[model samples]
Target: MRNTVLDMTRLATMDAEHANRLLHQVRAAILAGRRPPVAPRPVIDASWQRMLRLGFDPDGRTSSELLQPDELEHRRRATVIGEVMRTLSGGLTEIADASLQIMVVTDPQGRVLWREGNAGVMRRANGICLEEGAAWTEDTTGTNAIGTALAARRPVQVHSAEHFVHTLHNWTCAAAPVHDPRDGRLLGIVDVSGPASSFHPATLALVNSVARLAEAELRERHRRTVERLRSVAAPILCRLTGRALAVDPHGWTAAVTGMAPVDRLPLPKTFGAGRVWLPSLGMCTVEPLPGGWLVSPEESGPPEAANRVVLDLSRPRRWTVAVSGAAGSWTQELSPRHAELLYVLAKYPQGRSAAELAADVFGDPTRTVTVRAEMSRVRRYLAGVLAHRPYRFSEEVRVEVLRPSHPSDLLPHSSAPAVVGERQMPGQDVSAERRRS
Candidate 1:
């Protein structure tokens, strides 16, 4: 619950003889196709089960394949994670070197993008194929820190013999997932790894702290970018009136006139000059602006509540929610972010505040601004049904969610904290319903 790798730390502190005996018992149980011994923590037992399902052979050798230099360089250039790497590396370098450990950064898919520190350990790492460009996913490498942390969406430490592969039994690793501050998408992982003897309980805390710092840096960078956009929008908004606003590409409002400020609007991926239907504003004139979009509201009647809302998340890439009322039935395809927000809202019909929704979607309670902007868009479509002041669907309307036969397929592209947590819940046919008042 602390989100640190306290389990492995506890293992590290055990007397050598007791630790070895426990390890032996776990290994024997796993080899015999039995549940892990009680000595192994629940997280470790879960990892072992996942590895077994993935067809990993505990006795087999781990792969040492590295990506070609050109491919590695290309991936590094394309990732946003590179922007915060300098900050992460600076904080980790001294500690990594002092402990004879190596600091590794991996993309969400568990491909190692960078490695640094502990020259002697670096060379030794190569023998196990723990180098830049090598894939260390749980499916590929079996129960290592980097992959398991990504799988668990939290910090974890995997110590010697806890590793599924025999070849990695001599190593230890602590890793925490890093996320994009703007949307809670997993960007990569920051890991500290070395010979098992060099394992330290404090490393999990250190890694988690640095990962948080990296996310904060990303948030600051995004804020600065939005501020620059606001400067561009300022002069433009002065000439506009009558409930008009200027919004950046991601829908963050840069400026508003003759209207209360809204966090953001839902603009299509390829928005251009046109008349578009906006949720709260009805049909609106959309025009391209220097840094974003300028939208002016058009007249429309209040939304009718003789409606049923159906959330369809069964398809692969396409997610949609349909609204049916006396006016007619209409369905809107959702982007990954929108899909995640709606899913969380539907799950808790009791309603959620901006901060609560922020914590659910972004894993940070202070991101209410972001949550408010997104919810503004959601309200546009479900105007009469969605009520604010602690957002919730109107009790008079029935809500239903259609999910995939396999829960894992729900919102396949989302890595938002709440989405990840839902995917892991045990169920096949998942659905949530709220009845009319």
Candidate 2:
């Protein structure tokens, strides 16, 4: 007896309004991105019978075989990916079910970067279909869910006859390709699959939702990069221009109290964090500004010679304090350019490469030959001002320059250029200079 739940004649006479409502609901679910339940129908095909005779049961897989990592380093590989996915999915356990399966992340060239989902699901899915790390291009896998969606550059539902593989005729699958935001390049594909007779109209929506969630993870990573850049730029601005500046976490401008703003854009306090850069003062500011100490130049003399000022930013929004000691007093003796370089080093403190120091202090990274020439001048000036002092230039500054000892202190160091001083102060006076700045 032929068994077809979708009898054209019977379906033709069905209530038009009811069918329209069902289709409408499915579309809404797709746009809203909801996961739908699968329907159960009798599997009476010869393939099902053959599978039953051969003892194939997607639901009855043993723990060891399914969870086994194909590689010798299975535990190490599985632990990292499993923890990452679990965190990303927010304690999601549905995808860990025996019937569900893992879809490993792969490159366009079919290199696996990471795998998503549980081992049990991967094992069962592999027994009946493709397994983790399997090459799954449309040409090889034959136009099912994952491969087809990637080829089409859109989401898709491949039900029964849509699958090219004869063995896949008993399965229904939905898939969507995830893309990177920086270049809108394809990253990977996510798919949901199950027995053909258990197809759900909302499966397409589920696949799309999963893909979107993955994209959000990339957005967070970009935010972190921006934060690091702003952090590196802020103190340099304050030191060089003798201004108080800040960049908030959301990349917003806290203030440019002593520095001038450059390249103004429509800064919205409500939208993304505002980015403020003061070129003349050599200060860059970033949103929700952190409460900390702001180092500025004392107001009593020339901007170049002004004493060091430490403002307590712990309570009120902004206030200034006069810096004490010979090192703090020596600010007047240093040139504006030298003062800026020192501030950049103090703020950055992870001694910069010649190229990086040149870019931040001189605003040129490409002028390698010219930068080296200028470094000599900078080193000469530093020696004249802090000659015989504890401060010394270093070349090996790393990204995490000064590891914070406590919340208030920063271990300052520089590698911009070496100096030879004219006058040598006594060790006590040199020690005082070191403690003052």
Candidate 3:
């Protein structure tokens, strides 16, 4: 739902009378040589154009007017922000001498939602006014962390020269955009800032990881609410169904009008990994079982089903084959970088050292870290391959091992070559519960 109450309250607070007076004072200060309109002149950029297209409508609303104290109080924005601040602090504190000092969150519309950081960094960022309720659209604030992120919907790193604000030229920031799971909607942004000289490549990853963590929490909040509602409504449907459960998509459930004992209930999969949805009565998942489908409420259930059967075999013409590389050669199915990395790992039983692997592969010492990071990513890719098992690699002796899990061990005798599609990527097909970030 839209934040109607907060929006209405903000509009009332930023009334014309107050705005006119504030503008007059600003003009007077400029005339008296007490302040300048801004430190440097602003210029248009691609980020600005994007924000405008995204409905980041800017008017003359001040901080107080844009965010009402009452709404802030009711929503406990401070408390939530405080928790986010703590999470960020924990995420950054472990890095050795990490210069990251500030972090902030902003709504999808480019309004500052929350901010927290060290005193020194806050003082430095004050000129940009990154406090709660301030606008952070690229056009208004220039190419800063919050603005550029919302504009691009991707993680970005902006150094001193990239900052549009002249006074903010000494700082660098990295930010990532978070999305809502239900429809993959852009929700907010999370950003980290530090001195411009702190340009470690990992800085971007740190910011993205923080944003991902925050986005996870938000998704969990929504999932819990939906789960609770599902819990309450499930049993009621079970009692009425006479059949005890029903499973379908979200739209199917919405079409049913009056309550019936055997009403067709739609069960949109709660967690996307395993293909199943449970609707009504017991909250059990209506999953494909040995012969047909069965509903089970327990988290742990009988295994050996297919990966979501979207096709109905009774209707033969709907048969589809998801193609990748040819059989017995899964390595060939991956991208060039992924294919080479996996091939090397497959041959080395004891794995390899970072230096040894880099020399053999990329032939550059500086590329060692880069290769190691990609190996870390290969582990994530292996998750879908082995029922989400962790892939291990030693940095000291860089050998990738899958530890011979059940799924991985069983893969040798599997019917045919498995084609895990792009959906296997994190956040691609998981249901709302697992869609955190």
Candidate 4:
């Protein structure tokens, strides 16, 4: 018989009791370091692996101090998510209440910013401290929808026994992350949670739909804001005779004069009005617009040199690259894949071809197409330091990599073939590991 993936949703819909029992068995077996009768979903399995690696106790109590009243109020007013709360609540509140669940909205850090729904459910939630200001990130609450979705940077559903912590096994949650449509940064999470007995596979789909709707609302609002800014910018750019452009706070182009209209420009880390240097635009003068900035580049020599590169992967959750030289300095956060690729490059200064990189990352040299596409994206920002022929950092630039304290903890979110192999390596550094790879 061909082995196929298990369908937890269908099973739970038909017979929740049987499904719960089976999941308990599977969770117990997996936690005890044994093969389960059936495996959990890939997302859940990955979360469990991370928890295990960190020695998370499945039976331990889970809770954290609530945010102070003043800080909680400030967060509520500070996040962009607050702008879409009404839309999210309108789309999800009724459904959650009808299902005897609660609608929850959390900031990217997984702190509850707002929650509402069934009256009885609200009281029960208080028992678990699932109210405003509670931190629900995986580090504090284990593998559940709000925390796991935040960790994975995507939507997730955690049913009975799928949770790494025993306390959460009695609850079911479906959460989808809301990201800023302008730049793709995580804004927050929208979740529906209730007692395990109330589990409905369809709740996941509902939450995801509402999250997408919230993004649409944000996108439409931004369009109108930019249009208004354009009115203010068009006159300003035409008045002065120079390479001047107006951009939204996020660096989205609104109006331009004397240059090609670029959709967006990457702004420097420390951007402000007055004389400042941008790597792309060179020396520029900036002035505050109502919702954006007006940038005028002084007709000068050239953009600054970016010779030194520092890839910092020392933290478990965050990774960034800082570049600096004769001109100025700036930093950009690297995605998980980018971090892995950069780590590999930093190990072997000799560089790796597309095929070799595919083999190093996927353990399959045939996946060169994917490797090349990713390198193209990396090159977009690092064109100065990256070279193409064989896909390597330029020799003229110095590349420094900051590694995690424990080699095994490197790229905690990465399970690429090369990353996993390196994490399991016995040695201290990658010199001997390079030969093994």
Candidate 5:
């Protein structure tokens, strides 16, 4: 059956007209409750099944809804993907312009954040509601490159009849997901789209390359920001006492005293100077520094028994970890890095070394420094329930991971090598929910 599907893909790629005819036949067979003469590619077949399950009609007219001006502006400002849009757009501008293609960047939610390229193509796109601020998730707009790439967590190309919506059958698109390098979170997707005739196999590779470049740029920018904060924190750290650390606005550590360096500290969503009980750091006084916050530990309290840690990664966007023990319960919204770190820790109760964690999170075992720093910060809030040497949760604590119902949705934003490998693990039901005690 798999070989049959591969043969169909080869036939479709070799002859577009035949592909269209086969698609039409498949549609007819589906309507008649019969199988088509030739099977469609597996990806396309899976998309059709998803559309059917969602009660979407293949011939139904779906309207592309655009976000209001203010809403669009807010999305642009909040998305870090905007920082790399110019670079991605610039690289593809000439090719897209010449080929009458439009380049689009969308947030992880599939909301178009930016659109550029051929003027004529842009005008045509407006007709289909593909302009800025439009939503294009598979659930909303059927199976297109932007949405499918996100759903599959990989690059994808959709041509003509592969689109579930009849109105979109004349177009082709290639898209790749762009992830935040700090923590493998999906920032958005970059897509090149045009008429079906413009479909080229190379387009998928091109978009994938551009996506890589965008991630690299994001990483470099973060590195520079950390460097700046470190410079500002050096003199301040000199005067600090006890186990203290200076961290940037997002909790990336700049410097430390009396303790090993950490990758990031879990600051509250609304951060400011005051006395707060941090999970790993215990009770501490947080003071505002030049470029970051200075946290000074005040006490090391008694340990709590029968603690519970819940790592929630079920939603499309937000992720959080909830910790409850004798100190009381506190929930912190996780940054991508923290989420990945904790997820890995939850998967391995026995504990993982810095090198192992580095390999799991960043696909580089040599990045022990980065792993150690991240673990150091993680230890702050979870100090009582977490142990070092080999980082692991305390045996006394019960851990529950709230995973997405669908494996594809499990950390939908994460593209870390380890996370990706876990997503592909067999035997897990698409609808199974397990609570590990």
Candidate 6:
């Protein structure tokens, strides 16, 4: 299926009113349970199905509860996105103004954080409840570029009548999700919105590019922060008495002494200056550094409290592996490659050899060397709950897999032989709570 439903290329060449009318007919047919004249793009179709299941009223009012004024200001000040607001505005605001559109930036939860651009369109946006603090998630506002891009975790363009909400049919939007480059956490969305006449297929590309630029800025900022932390850690580690390392809040290692350096330390979420047990390090004393933590490992037997491991592959963009035991619990967000490997291990708790894992993950048994290297890295942090003889979780560890609410969302970006097969599984929702992904 094409990435866009309405083919803005064709629509750009057609009369605006006529193109809108044609898509209106298609949407009307879809809502009436008849086949659309042209099937909506796959993303739109999935979103419409989700809306139908949600029992949304296409004709209902498009308002969302606006965040209180103070709350709005609080969110604006609390995120790094605020630091780069000038970059976002400077990059898109002029173009949006020239094109009769408004630029919008939303938090990860889809609440409007900041918006600027064409003055007239900004007023029109207010009429549709697109003002600061209004929610624009899929469930709240129907199929829209901002909401759909959040769900899809990718750039999207929603043209006139392609919107599931009838009131939004006169408007058009393009959006792309911005993620924190340091850890790949979604920061929010950047969008361009205006009247249907302002629709341009290229808007999605532009929004996507600007979103990337925003991430690049964040990455550079994080690099500088880590460098400063390294400077602070250098002299401190020199006086350390045992195997110690300095790591940023997110676990990125700044420096290490008396041990081989690893890229990260996998600290717990609630890590602070105190004695703590880690999955990788048996027991350690942590102290506060200038912008990070100083960790000193104790020479002792590792705790065996990791009785449960939950591999979560439910979200489209983020995946986590959480471990719990008497010692406490820590959650490590998995990289994409690690997520795929863990999913396969969770599915086959009995075990998988290096060759078998290679086949499952890369569809090539000869890739065992690569598989072994990855497993070596995975074991570095998960040594407490993982066994390497056959590359499986420790027999004592109970494992659970949290699949997506929708099968297609299971490792949505993975192409591994194992994950792809799971994606084709019909009606799969493996969450232990039967909750949404």
How do all models score by TM-score?
Answer: 0.75, 0.36, 0.41, 0.86, 0.77, 0.85
Candidate 6 lDDT over residue span 328-373, tens digit each: 7888888778998988887777789999999999999999889999
lDDT of 1: 0.79
Instruction: Kindly list the per-residue Cα lDDT of model 2 for residues 356-398, writing each as its tens digit.
Output: 7566655666766664554454443232222112232332221
Ranking by lDDT: 6, 4, 1, 5, 3, 2
- Candidate 6 off by > 4 Å: 1-18, 302-305, 312-319, 334-341, 350-381, 384-396, 403-437
Q: Which runs of model 2 end up more than 4 angstroms from their true locations?
A: 1-84, 87-107, 110-124, 237-437
The best candidate in terms of TM-score: 4
The digit string of per-residue lDDT tens for model 5 on 138-249 reads 8888888898877766788887877888888888899998988765667899999998878787888888998899898988898898898889888878886667888877
* Tens-place lDDT digits, model 3, residues 310-364: 1111110111111111111111112224444543443443455666556545655
lDDT of each structure?
0.79, 0.41, 0.44, 0.82, 0.78, 0.85
Cα lDDT tens digits, model 4, 129-216, are 8999999988888888998887666789999899999988889999998988786678889999999998877888989999999999
- lDDT for 97 (candidate 6): 99
- Give each model's clash number: 2, 18, 12, 0, 9, 0
Report the poorest 10 consecutive residues by lDDT, candidate 4.
428-437
Ranking by TM-score: 4, 6, 5, 1, 3, 2
Candidate 5 regions with alpha-carbon error over 4 angstroms = 1-3, 6-13, 23-46, 268-270, 301-306, 328-394, 401-437
Worst 10 residues of 1 by lDDT: 1-10
